[model samples]
Target: MSVENVRPVQSNCLLEVCVDSVAGLECAIEGGADRIELCSSLELGGLTPSAGFMQTAAHISPVPVYALNRPRSGDFVYSVLELDLIERDIEQARAAGLDGVVIGVSLPDLRLDIGALTRLKTAAKGLDCTLHRAFDLVPDFDVALEQAITLGFSRILSSGGALSAEQGLAMLRHLCKRSSGRISIMPGGGVGALNVPQFMALDGIKEVHGSCSSPSEAVHAKVTALGFASESSKHTDASKVRALKAALLVPSSD
Candidate 1:
């Protein structure tokens, strides 16, 4: 299996579950997630979790937790004020004793904003960093991969520029091989227990990310009517998390 820029698996695949609420956080741990990506709104593709949420997770989670450092919704093209907020949030995650921060910033032309990322990375020094899905938005993954590695990102959560990991398997596999083991290329987006086994054997994969979420049992009719919540809401499901963990043990063709 020797290949250019590729390495052997150093360890078993780790399950990283992304969560928005305290309940989701609890469920992720309870379901055996090796790590947690703390954020505010899954519906918005994950925003920075509040200081309070980080604090709560610090108190509640036994496993390592990383805060998503996105300041707002829309694009990854952040403004100066938003960058300020993101830096503050990175400090907050460290203050809350969280393990790391997930971050990404993009240019108008959809390239990784190197200057902005360098600043954020400086602020997040001494903590782990995961480059978020904004990597998928880049025009060239090979270029972005080099930039991300140089910026000191410990891992990257991406769906290979596609809507789902299954649909982007070829690119994802290439990224894994290309990354070797210099930086972890974690496949995510529409990932779940049912299909996790498929990703277990990539050349440089060491971790995988998923929401492990399901429809909220009681979507409170009144809450939706008042526009406080969407009628079709989802929450982290402990069973899904456990299933994903179990799935990771299976061998894969890939």
Candidate 2:
């Protein structure tokens, strides 16, 4: 870790909760999340939230809310049309009074697409930016970390190039050290209250992210059979958020 950009140690770890609906947003806030990552289609790994969702989240969430700017599912590699869509989505986030935006662009080879990221960063000026988990797909983490820093992203939301933060503890620690104070490394993916202690144990990991969603409830059999919704869909639980915040010593609206 460079001494010059030494990351400051936090007195308490912050909890960033991901929410895909107004109900989830309310739950996260009621549960005491310090930050919110507002999005849609979380099962699709989170897509850019609708303008209405962004606006509503800004109005209701007392905590800083960062809107996911991803335009689609599949890979982060984007076409000109998709890039244009992403640019406008970012503008919408800012116009909706969001606190920040989460974004990433990748090459077909699984490396960060510097040109595309640069363009998106310019559009997101005046709002904080987070390099979202498209980072997990990077072929090289060290090179990608430097790219994120050079891009002026406030932080990188990653799982240490792994599927979950717990499984990637080693690499996550290294990233914490590598980032020093130049930027923050926020671990997400399968992180939650019960096992959050494992992640907060890392030195530079001052913040963590997760869905805090409860298991999907059984819906009417016909609902799934008719394709109204997936039987496996999960919903955010206020109790789970409160539990996590309690574990982290964060205050809640309750």
Candidate 3:
């Protein structure tokens, strides 16, 4: 569906939960997520999920599912072949019936890759597109914000160049004000029940993105059985998602 045609979320302040597995998807949905960002290997900083996974999540999720289209873990600057791969991923997401795709591209100078993004946007066609956290790596936030708006991204997911949304509150507010409804500035990274109230106070934050993740003992055991030194397996926690949603509804102290 076109970005404009996407259904309004159930709550005024939408909660977007990022999940890597079917189990995580189930948890996010039960936890009252308004939307889901389907991906794989969150430890690698999120890679494009398999088509089967995307189809399964889209089929099972009640809310809109937006697939992450990153080809690799390292950086936002991609080679031509890598861009082609991303284009194919976007096509796969569309064919899988996902509501949107999250993506971003950058130049060596840390500027937005307008040409590459334009082609990716074309490949996305009718689906809603979000410029992902790659926005944080850009050298100039103001310039990048205008480029994202001109490129027609439905929203930009960022932590305002800080390590976490709470740490970047000031820049988040600045970007939100500068956006002026032309595009959405979604505060993500380290957002959870405890700090969501701070974001709610920001005037133009219509949506928030987070993993709301916690360590999973089951998965950790499996990894250990395979002889890998598993630090800990993380998955979206249903209770955390519910808590965040509840916190978003409470009036901010502002």
Candidate 4:
């Protein structure tokens, strides 16, 4: 079904599955994901996907696809040249008819780079803009949350500055309370069927993100022989995605 045709779950909470490959896209769709974040290397915390990958995935994906806009790996801070490149990529994502773009920029002090973020949002004028996990890198969560809201991000993907949503529940809850409907605080990182209920129980959380990924031996064998690939090229498992989605849709009796 097309994204427009897919109905929201009874609970009204959204499930966003992060995927790096077309195979993973198919799995997410088959498993009834509410949305998909398209990227290349999830191991490096997700890099911008190629134009071809974005186009192909957009063409076939049943749900809306949001492209990650980071130019390179190490940090959220970008040089002028890198910012230009990121702008170009955002345009490419728009041209490819993607539903949205995920992006973030921070200073050395680990604060939101408002200037860069403004320019990037301008470049992505028509697309939904999600502030990615770069929120987790910020030194102050409250200040960063206000900054993201001021920058007009549709949502902020975060793990509460912790390694996983479970680990950061306190901060996540605080963000939701402070947001007060001005912005969305979407908890990501290590969210799964096993722990989604804990997040769902939070008062203001309306969305969640996860890779729902499982190791694929076939994928491992294909890349490991190249002498450079680690056993980290995982694919989204449809069954796992289904379980996660099912868990979110059902109300917790506890």
The models' CA-based lDDT, in order, is: 0.87, 0.88, 0.89, 0.88
Model 4, residue 164: C-alpha shift (Å)? 0.7
Q: What lDDT tens digits, residue by residue, belong to model 4 across residues 1-254?
A: 45335443444589999988888878888788889999988888899999999999778776789999988889898999999999999999999999999999989887999999999999999999999988999888888998999899989998999999899999999999999989988999999999999998888889999999998766556568886677656778989988999888865678
Q: How does residue 71 of candidate 2 score in lDDT?
A: 86
Model 2 ranges with Cα > 4 A deviation = 1-11, 250-254
Q: List the residue pairs that clash in candidate 3.
A: none
lDDT of 1 by residue, 197-249 (tens): 67776677778999999898776689889999987789999899878887776
- lDDT by residue (106-140, candidate 3, tens digit) is 89987999999999999999999999998999989
The TM-score obtained by model 2 is: 0.92
Error of 3 at 132 (Å): 0.3
Please report the TM-score between candidate 1 and the true structure. 0.93
lDDT (tens digit, per residue) of candidate 2 on 1-254: 22222222222788899999888888888777888999999889999899999999887777789999888889999999999999999999999999999999999999999999999999999999999988999888999999999999999998887888889889999999999979999989888878888888888778889899997788999999999889889999988987887777645466
User: In model 1, which regions exceed 4 Å deviation?
Assistant: 1-11, 250-254
Q: Candidate 2, 184: how far from true, in Å?
A: 0.3
* Model 3 / residue 198 / CA error / Å: 0.7
After superposing candidate 3, which stretches have Cα over 4 Å from the reference?
Answer: 1-9, 218-222, 225-229, 251-254
